[model samples]
Target: MNMTSYEEMFDEYVKSSAAYCASLFEATEYFFKANAALEATIVSTNTAKTSTIHSIQEYFETCKISLIKTIDLLRTFQEIHTTIPGEQVEVDFAQQYFYIKKTLSCVEQIIQLFSTVRDDKNLQQQIWDNDDFTTYFTTSADSISQAIIWQCNFAKRANLDESI
Candidate 1:
């Protein structure tokens, strides 16, 4: 490819990849915000009982936003990878892709689980009924962070310039 063409491809890849990273960060922030809202509701007094349901509602909103962001990022990642082609598909790139795939799977499952209980009269109650909710949520969140870290490490090692 000509130098300008290569530079254009590089710029496209970098922009898309950076967008994916930004979406990931936004999702992570929403996840934490949801967690904090839930926790705050748990510690509130009887007078603030309404806050319980409100907090749960907030959590749902944030979770939905995060899920949407993740889906968008995943699609963008795929397009960037496919369009870039050739040399960009290095070993580290493949590894990072796998990590992202795993993270996407986990996020999908979380969204599915939440969807089933989303319309329940008492979301907090449904969540409380699930003994594994905390463990599942914490583990999934940690896995996502690990996957993002793995992707960053791969990019750095490969000198891909998409690190962020």
Candidate 2:
């Protein structure tokens, strides 16, 4: 496939990923509201809260997997085009830089929200007290961080400003 086709695929992935991140943020907000309501009603049970945490964790895992796949696709594109002429590659890199910036913004928002959720006293206790949950959450966060780092490195290699 040509660079244009790769660009199209990258665009679609970014759009989808951004939409997914937005939905996850919204869901987290809703979860907070629901938890508050349950607490106000004196009906907030540990089981219900734990279930919600699990649901959010699952969502995080799905997002992480999607990001990793997207990064792999980007790596494949880079490897295949490694021998392309400089001028053409630079043009393609310039376009990809914007897409990467947009993706970084979405990922950063999700990361911040995830940190908030993870740091909540109740959620922290539940996650930390469970060995499996602790490992899962940690692994998910690490994987996502690595994916972000890979993208940043790619931008740097292309001589794009890190500020993006």
Candidate 3:
């Protein structure tokens, strides 16, 4: 509509897009963390990984809610996160980028959001437990770079149109 209104909308879109990116990184981190926790469960009880899995699942939900005001808001604008065919799931990144660039996008967004927050360990731990974010982030940029390379090769072989 108006100039300020446009800026506000652009800002909102950036915030939401950043959130969408944030959730994926959070979920990926949760996946690896849960994987470790699940291993512990298997050794201790030889039982299901239910507790660890549930914990990770809960984290994902918290991430989703924290990322958006409402589910409808998410459905309305998550273009950056693409869906796969057949299952028609709402998700992000190809399997090739699973552990690389795709994951880095999340880490960057979370850091940006958390940078503005102050002294809130509870909130921090809620998205990502403890302070091992740096550990996961150390090689993030490089990994993402590798993913970009793979995506380029894949696109050429598949003869797909350039990504919009």
Candidate 4:
């Protein structure tokens, strides 16, 4: 089997997305805290407010969208290797830079999205205002930070060394 540049980058990209999927379950706690806060504020209003579960649903929906995009990117990357078979073809790193960059960008976007959604201060403050805001906030923040750590560690292992 020939290892094309596409295969190399695709493998790395799969690792990136797969790690995100694994960590997302753990990541739910962060959003859960944020959602609890958002629900409190939204529910308190006279008008209909988005429920905590609903917001979480929306978030996972967003994650689904990201997943689709990631899978599509993988398919496109895989396509590059499909045309030729049984030949040891060398893939140029320089040549695949754009696709690799795009994959990296997708990973960054997912990480940033997770960070932002999990740490929306206004919603957090509103949700736990009646309770202990400080502890709630700290714990929630820590969860997001951990997610970032998980992502960064995976990147480092893959020799990407990106601090997501």
Which is the leading candidate under lDDT? 1
Q: Rank the candidates by TM-score, best first.
A: 1, 2, 3, 4
Error of 2 at 2 (Å): 14
Q: In the order shown, what is each candidate's alpha-carbon RMSD?
A: 5.0, 10.3, 15.4, 12.6
Q: What's the CA error at residue 158 for candidate 2, in Å? A: 1.2
TM-score comparison, 1 vs 4, better candidate: 1
What is the clash count for each candidate, in the order shown? 0, 0, 1, 1
Q: Per-residue alpha-carbon lDDT of model 3 for 1-164, expressed as tens digits?
A: 56886566656656765554455445445535543453454445434543443453454344434333322334443442232122222234344435443444554454554444343224334435534454544454445445445445544543443332
lDDT by residue for model 2 (9-31), tens: 66665555455444434433443
Which one wins by lDDT: 1 or 2?
1
Candidate 4 lDDT over residue span 1-164, tens digit each: 55686587657656655654454443344345444645564545343554443455455445444444544543444454444344423333232334323333443443344344443335545434434444443444454445445445644644553333
How does residue 117 of candidate 2 score in lDDT?
Answer: 54
- The reply for model 1, stretches above 4 Å from the true place, is 46-52, 82-129, 160-164
Q: Model 4: which residue pairs collide?
A: 37-127
Tens-place lDDT per residue, model 1, 26-65, is 7667666666666665555344443444455465466556
Report the lDDT of model 3 for residue 16. 65
Predict model 3's lDDT versus the native: 0.44
Decoy 2 TM-score against native: 0.38
Superior by lDDT: candidate 2 or candidate 4: 2
What TM-score would each prediction reach against the true structure? 0.63, 0.38, 0.34, 0.32
Best-performing candidate as measured by TM-score: 1
The lDDT values for all models are 0.62, 0.46, 0.44, 0.45
